[model samples]
Target: MTVETIDTVVVGGGQAGIAMSEHLTSHAIPHIVLERHRIAERWRSERWDSLVANGPAWHDRFPGLKFDDLDPDAFAPKERVADYFVQYAEKIGAPVRTGVEVNSVTRLDGRPGFRVETSRGVIEARNIVAATGPFQKPVIPQIVPEDADIFQIHSNRYRNPEQLPEGAVLVVGAGASGAQIGAELMRTGRRVYLAAGPHDRPPRSYRGRDFCWWLGVLGKWDLAAPAPGTEHVSIAVSGANGGETVDFRALAREGLTLVGRAERYANGILYFGAGLVQSIRHGDANYLSVLDEADAYIARNGLDLPEEPEARDFGSEPECLTAPIRALDLADAGITSIIWATGYALDYSWLDVDAFDEMGRPAHQRGKSTEPGVYFLGLPWQSRRGSSFIWGVWHDARHVADSIATQRSYLEYHAQAEARSA
Candidate 1:
């Protein structure tokens, strides 16, 4: 295999990687983007057809490009977002090596650099940018029973409801994806079940405005201020406008059965505890508590916000669970199609760097990692609102590239001084 040397090597040519490449290009920094597949391949192949982004067009843009002439509140189709990523890469002229799967990255002994081994070839770089992104793996719970004859798939593989078995299908994990899929299935005359999990509660319209109007005024606008610890963990802003005000309410109203959290699955049977409904009730209360906390924070801080946007009420409460249903319990509900929307984690075993935290995520502060000349960009929650959406990644990528340039300059200055003294 041929070996090459470069100033930087970016792993994964997704939005993060492409954005970083653009930043490096602007500064005349030489870098190569190594992608396992074609750019935006994951989005094109993994996401379902009905899958739409919670973020609007303006918020879904990348560096040097803006998603225009699209509905601001409308849920953008999967294809549109995927195409945007591809166009963004080409627009910036990123040097992307497609079909190259990086096996491992080992630190070189004397050069203080990294040697990246990939299927296409081997490359040595002064710095390595791990831009694989958080959505690298699909999360399916072990609670699903192996004996169940019913079809089961993760949100990644699911494309449409027609692909599911013609029976009552249970969707596990009632986050944005699960709730949206469950609601759509029920509308299509399929018996659907949704399992609830911890989620944030949204208001009808704050006082009397579009939820996004308030979010833009209050949440997205004040991005520079550091977010609270709670905000970093979970923050609830209004979802896209639809028939249902909230996902849980919409799914419940559409004749979808609500169930308790899945305890354990075996022998084609799922079991639930008696306090499942009570747990749902507690979750609702917890959501309200968090919202109230956020409101109080806004009031105390005296942050200027827009007038509460008005929205029509979609009604409240469902008859099946008999409790204020926010989250669905998996075990109590006999769901066959277990769609895990619990979230994602970064698993980087191929990376030999020791700078990662216990969770396999690279440890970084403001895009600068502990390893000299190395960095990361586009991580979920990397900086407040930095990795929340496509537009956010550009801000992070610029910051990281700037830091890389600064560090490279320092290294050059020290090296030249040492050479002259010797």
Candidate 2:
């Protein structure tokens, strides 16, 4: 096979890859983006039809391009998001090779680069950026039984309530996806049950301003350190309008039965852990703490802002917090379908290099890997809290591109010095 060479090779042509490509193009770097499917394939194929961005359009723009024609505050639908990526790629004239799947990335033998094995062909690159994104595959636990009697689908596969089998539905995992899916299912008059988990609940809008706006102003997105015991805190937002709030409390109030964290499915029965009410309360407290921190920042800066909105009574409907059942037989509950919104797992099996830690996560400082030319992008808290989001990936991308350029310059300089001596 004839081997092709490039300055850089970017894997996965989603928002992260596209952003990285834009920076590389601006830097005049000869790089190619290899995507297994179409650009933003997750938005196109994995997401539900009704799914919209959890954040507003205004905040989701790429570095140079803004959402000019669309409403800034409106939540962009999945289709629009996919189109935006395509348009962005075209606008920048990105060297993106769609439908090209990368099989493995290994060091070039006795060389100072990487060999990227792909479906198309082999690509030798001076640098490689893994932009596969944070959400790689749906993480449905092995705990979910293999029984054929009940239908099961991950949130990525779920389209709408009408697509589900007749009868009640169990939505596992109460993060943004779970809360939104449960709420949507409940609207269809289906008996929706949500399994609550450890999550953060921030109101969609607070004090007549979008919570995201406050988070931006307060530098919440700039926070890089994770909370002591948590890997990352999931934001609770719905894509109803440009965006809306969706939390366990709201879902419970919407007539969706709230249950504890799903422990296991055994013998035709689903068992749940206790502390459903406590979990809701804990999430609410965490949300309040964030608001308090923002308020403190405003005060420290002496910025004249609007008066803080009166604390809304989140506890008004206490009945929703009650966990009436800890275990339910699948048949007795009349639940015919289960949607696993448990979250996603990042896979780096294609990386045939020692750049990962014992936990199987990339060992990198910021976005640069310990192994000279290898780098990572679109990782949660890779550089900051926004690193994983569409609006945030550009920051990390710019850093990676600049780092690659610097490494290439140093290598070229050394090569010239050695030639002069010769």
Candidate 3:
């Protein structure tokens, strides 16, 4: 079979792939970036129409690039963020080939490289960087049967509330996506119910600064990720309405029905646990933890930062928590649609390398996988808490590029030495 050969192949064309290409080019490494779709396709297609980045514009961006005349603290609209990646890729002359889908990656037979099989053709590379990212396949638990009466869609497929069928909406999973979508649906004069789960709630801003700034300054962003296959709690925060915190109490007052994590859907009814208050408290504790850390930092450093009184006030408990229901009859509530904001599952089945743990999570230190010449980028907690984020992913791409370059040089040196002896 005829096969194209390159020094390196980077899978994906999102922020991570493009960033990897930039670093590879800087290292004078010849490579090709294969993108299944257009650059930042997920941002353009997968996300909801009203979605805004959780991070502020300045903090979410790559190094030496601005989000086009926007203020530092302003949360960039989704389209603008996609445009920024495209613009950055073009500026850096990234070798991105769009619409080229990679089917599998396997080691070359008795060779020191990998064979990447794609829809276009086969390409052999000395090294491969799996930058497909954390959000791949949408995860939908089988709590509800396939023949359920209510229409269901994952957050990945949701565009806007208008697309959903008429009736009350039950949004399962109260992560950033679910909470924002649930709130948006409520604003459209539709009855919305949110299924609270284990998630951290961070304030949009603390002490006259965006939470992004505080995370960076306080070294929270430098926090390490848990071991591979370990589940991490979602951070439920939003950039909606310029920047707003999700106060369950406020959402409750605004007519949002808060329930515990969805247990099951049976007999035309949805069942929930009695952990509604505990779920809210989980978020409250996270919210308070960050505030306490920031406060201590200011006090220890003798920095004069004004304390916001309203933020610390966790008012009286809402009725939903005081009296949590165990079940919701779908027909009685007039619920016609269910949006599962249950997040995405990582899919590395196409990777024919022994670079993953038993749970199929990438088994690696930082971005380097266990298998030589096989690396992973943009994984959640791949190295740090910020590893999956745009900026953090970019930084990780640089590190991966350095590793590839160093390994390539070592291999070439050994090959030359063997040739001289021969």
Candidate 4:
């Protein structure tokens, strides 16, 4: 295959890739962004029909543009979000080639660049940024056998409740997606059972300010990743219902049976972990801790923010936590569907570089890999807690662009030195 040469090759067209492209353009770098689908395709296709942006419009966007038509506190619908990125790319003239899929990234042996193999063609780039974003592959736990009679779909493909079979649903994994979906199904008169798991609950709003604002002002956004395993764990906050706090205890009161984590399937029966109460308590603690931190910040700064009573009240743990369900028979409960919102699995199988950890995660320092001219973007906790969020991606992208520019200058300097020696 003929190789198309470029200075940089960005591997995604989503928020991360586009953001990286914008920075590279500003640096006067010659690069191309290859996307498997359209820009911000996940927001348009992978998400559920009712999904909205995680943060309010004013806060979660690039510096060049404000979501002009949207209110400061309002969360933009997913369609608008996709449109916003598309507009941003156009405004900055991002060179994004849609429908181009990158198959692998390997070094240009005995050289200082990379050979990116893609579906459309080959691209030999001096530098590469793997801006593939966090949600690469759906992670469906093997709790249920493939032959199980119940219908199953990952949250990536779930559009709405009406798409499922005419029966109750068992939603597995209670993160943002699962909680929002479970609540939606329950509202539509469908009997729902949610398999609760360890998730952080950040209030939708605290003292008249969005949770993101609190995180930013308190420097939580700048903080590094937490525990190793919890780095990828999603927060249980939803933009639906005009920004709602995902409280499992409240959902239980609304008739949704909250169960523990789905463990394994044996003898045609599903077993659950016995830490239902602990999981709920963990979310409650996180919720309270956030409120407490916000209150502390207000007091320290002497801000006039009023106390939010409801934000602090997460409700009492439901009985399911105390008397956890040991087993579940899908047929007995009339449940014919299972939605797996169990987060994503990191898939960098196409990376032909020694720049990953034992956990299969990219081993990079602030987006720069140990392997020269190779970088990773849109990763969880890449630089800060907000690294993966849309509002924060541009910061990481800028850093990656700076790294690329610096390396390019170094290479240019070395080439000049070699020419002088000759």
Candidate lDDT values, in order: 0.69, 0.85, 0.90, 0.88
- Candidates 1 and 2 compared: the better one by TM-score is 2
Please report the TM-score between candidate 2 and the true structure: 0.95
lDDT of 2 by residue, 1-422 (tens): 79999989999899999999999987899999999999999999998889988888878778678777678888888899999999999999999999899999999899789999999889999888999998997888776676648899999999988899999999988788888888889988999888887788887776556777888887788998777876755556676855666656555676789888889777888888887877777788877886687678778988676765654456455464653578989899899999999889889999988898889989999999888889999999999988898989988999999898888788889999999999
Ranking by TM-score: 3, 4, 2, 1
lDDT string, candidate 4, 1-422, tens digits: 56799999998999999999989988899999999999999999999999988888888888899999998888899999999999999999999999998899888878778888898988999888888889999989888877888799999999998899999999998888899999999999999999987889888887889988888898899988786677555688888988877778888988899988899888768888888888888887888888898898899989998777866655676677667797988788898999999999778889898888877778899999877788999988899989999978999999999988888788889989999999
- Give the better candidate number (1 or 4) by TM-score: 4
Residue lDDT tens for model 1, 1-422: 56899999998888889889999998889999999988978778987776666655645576477766476545567777788878888887899999999999989997679989989778999889988887877777777655555577888888888787556787776666666777777888888876664455455344333444445655643365444533423322323343134546556776887776666665656654455466455446644543464466568877665533233233576775675333433334444466665556567878888777777668889668877766877776687654646777778888888888887889889999999999
Model 4 spans > 4 angstroms off: none
TM-score (all chains, Cα) for each model: 0.84, 0.95, 0.97, 0.96
Comparing 2 with 3 on lDDT, the higher-scoring candidate is: 3
TM-score of 3: 0.97
Error of 2 at 186 (Å): 0.4
Q: What's model 3's overall lDDT?
A: 0.90
User: Cα RMSDs of all predictions?
Assistant: 4.4, 1.8, 1.6, 1.5
